[model samples]
Target: MLVSLIFKRTYRPNVNTIQWNKTIQNHQSNGNYQQALKLFQLGIEKNTFQPNSVTYLTILDICKELKSLPTVRKIHHLIDESKNLNNDDIQNNPRIRSLLMDVYIKCQDIDSAYKIFQSMNERNLIDYCAIMTGFNHQKQYEKTFELSKQIPASIKYSSPVLCTLILQACIELNKYDDGYKIHQYGKKFLPNNKIFMNELLNFYLKFHQEKQALDIFDKYQNQQTIIDYSLLMKYYNRQYQPDKTIELCYRLKNHSHIQIDHIIYVLVLQAIANGCCLHTSEQIYNQIKKSQTHMDINNALINMYGKLGNLDQAEKIFNSMSKHNIVSYNILLNLYGLYYQSDKALKTYHQMCQHGHQPDDKTYVLLLHTLSQTPNKINDVKRIFSTIEEHKRGPMVTAAMIAALIRAQLFDEVNDLLKKLPKENILFYAMKANSNETNEKFHYPISITNEQLALYDLLMSNIYTYAGLHDRLTNVDEILYENKILKDRLSYSWFERSNGKIEYFKSEQLQLKTCEHTEKLALINALDEQKNSSSPILIGKNHRTCTECHDYFKKVSLSSSQKKVYLRDSTRFHIFSNGTCSCEISS
Candidate 1:
């Protein structure tokens, strides 16, 4: 009777098997994928019972979830050893192969995925798409192209994913002609599919076909994805159309189906900041405050306020932050340096150190620049230059330091530093500094310094002699006034302008009998050329403008129908209009 009962029973899973399967299912359902995999590994190691096909399938799912190649390989080995499991089973079930292929591809094991793909007897559209995607992911462009060409026309045309992959390949290779042809062929598949449509739009943008790009965007902007909006904002920002960028930002904000993200806000903030529209910037700031609190948003606001020249507001934002990063301090340090607030810049640097932020190369560079402007901070400049040399910074910092020294009129130190500088043209001939030294060797090498130095010498001599002065009221002016004859003979006779034409007016042209100022010569030439138009004439004087040119511009402004004259003298900018100069009261 017992034998009869045993013979009557069918092969059913025992209690252990039922418990193991339930545990895996429970963990997987709960999204505890790693625990699911670990329990499966433990069940196999126990060898309590033989795993059925369903068990192997569950293991494959876990491997795919983990995207682990080693575990997939272990499962593949176990399946090969099992008598019940074989390639025939895999061949019969394409899903197992697809799962394995997905795991391999996700692990960036393109070769293994390709082998699995090729082993399939009857390949489908998905298999072809998966392999092509693998190649694309690996940036194996040639392999992708070769595989794409081999796909059947019928299969390729029906699969939008395949078509999109081919388009991406063409885009990556910068094959504009081929991409355009393929895009026109696949236009029918792009209506409802945002992924492929964006690829098509990207192709047009890559080739700089703005009209075509905009046309494509307008056709599909209603159905575009978040990525599509981001790309469009980037394009507009690149084109310097801040208004369009902000418009798109507002549009994205109002989209019912789309959720605005922090990344989009960061990009839009850059656009509005550059527009200098502080009103729009304030609105965005309020939005960011409501929904987001990130270091990036804070940094962008700091940059925007700095650009608008509101350092107090920038500092307020900086102080409001509970946390600070290197970039945050960098922004404030650069702001102080840009405005030439040496004390504030130095204080910011010390504060950054106190906050445990290590200074980078840019920090040191900004400090060097600030120190250069503060002539009284010469000792700090020396210390910073030492740090720069210790870190083996490049020639730019060294060059800047040398230039700072020269501007400070520390010519002896400049000569010593120039010898240490690398053999660049600007640094090479900087050893020569004295203008009164008669030795040709001590003079700047004309070949390397080029004609700019020649022009500089001519301008300097003009100011040194005060050749345009109406009266020698001061004794120092009297001695220089007496030395004009030899200086005038040695100075430049003519100079050139941007029009490729030379204006030849010797010192004889000066209303002053002794000499003509170089800046006066250039101004007279510029005004005479553009006498008919009532536009401001810009003149750059390398040295301080002589009293004669100052008086001349005032007279020119009043007499020439209010023709403004802007003079950028050595120290500051002076605007002359209607017989009045900006520096009139200060002088």
Candidate 2:
């Protein structure tokens, strides 16, 4: 009878433990982590079963998913106590230790994770990866680099995951030399590993080592994923090489093995918009419309069409959306503003408000800009400005309001607003310089540091030119030249051909001195191309259209036998036809 009782006492616990582990694993596999955690807690409280390493590991995983730091610590303590109860020494088990480290990292307790790593009897690759990744996740890049140096020399080549993390650390530390060395090591030891290769490409790109980045990209072009292409295109776009961005888009489209995801589609559309390739934009749009729609893609299309001066297409896309987000409404409002349709913009704003989509800062700014263009809408501008929350009225909003009052010839009101602005405000100085009625001498504040002085000078020069104060403009220009702050903002334009080729022309490339301005050169090219094509001329300008170029475009439209010109400048689209432009005509 004694033997039978003892056997049952020992045997029943093992059976219960097996059942509990199976049940917990089943719940975890089904993604019922919370239920699994409850079962673990019940088992611990009931004390009916002894939890083996499997049970501890499973529960730890559950804690990780829940990000329950308390539960993890409890489990860790129980595991420690289990050394006496069940003879399960965690010191001998690397798996439990690694899992504990992972849980600690997931719970954002890197200190505890590192302690576990330090207590490990045998520090394998997995152990190193866990703690190093934790350090990286915590943004302890210096610690990550320090740990990498401690890696055992016996381990021949670093794992791809480890190498990637190290490269990321190098990037954060701005250790370009170390990153280059890793790239060389990866090429030799981790050859053809796409994960490591991609990291290598990113490291080079982040440092603006474009030549080396392109080398990797060209070599691994066949193996490049959508992410790699996206990164390259983004890098080129940031570098202001929109032409190269478009080229990459074409290459990505032609790659047979690659699938064009929504992200890539949005990026391609952005490049097309930046390059002002109307034909390419249409082709891409046709492809997009046939696929499953994404809101981002639709937003990009709306923005692209708006830039292309195709308002009808933009509106059509906006109306087709079953759901509207704040971005969608803002883009529509901006479109109306771009075409100088103040009434339509106001209507859209009302519709947006009715839809319960609150206007953001961008929406308010666009509304102010649109309303300020029409003389009759000054009251509407005032009403909208009054409704804006106090915190939202920053320099940009106040500047827009000031410009509106100036346009309305409300000089006294403008002066009042200007006085309220702090002297350190660059926009305040710009507005003061722009107003013809104000003869206030420009005062440079002591707080305006050297870095801001260049921007201030440039802003004043633009204001002087816009106000037709040529003497003031020339004076600012000399200041800019003396300080070596004036840069030749060379003008350029691009247009798409029927064959999907984008032809680019720079102001310096024009043979005739009269065609030195970007818009004139673009018009000359467009008229020459008009003989063979019936499509409207769409030119993308690199800078805002000056008044001289605006007048030139108007005169050209009057005499060009009804040739429509769509010039997308830095500020907005200027669609010229029949001697009329989409922009509000200045008095």
Top TM-score hit: 2
TM-scores of all models?
0.58, 0.78
lDDT of 1 at 522: 70
Q: What lDDT would each prediction earn against the true structure?
A: 0.65, 0.73
lDDT computed for candidate 1:
0.65
- Candidate 1, 446-527: lDDT as tens digits: 2322122322332233333333433222222222234343233322323223342334433443233332466677777878
Candidate 2 local lDDT, 1-587, one digit each (tens)? 22222223322245788899999999999999999988877766555676787888888888888998887887887666555444544436789989998999999999999998888878888778788888988899999888888887454146777778889999999999988877766676433677787788789998989999888888766688887888888877655566677778778879999988898888888788777777777777788878899999999889888878789989998989898899998888877766788888999999999999988767887788777777899999999999987666776567667767766778688777776666657667655554566755565442333224423433443444446652333322232233221222324667876667777766443222222466677777777876677678888775445667778888887887456788876556787877878665531
Runs in model 1 deviating more than 4 A are: 1-23, 32-35, 67-69, 80-87, 90-93, 118-122, 131-146, 250-261, 278-294, 324-330, 341-587
In terms of lDDT, the best-performing candidate is 2
User: Per-residue lDDT for 278 in model 1?
Assistant: 41
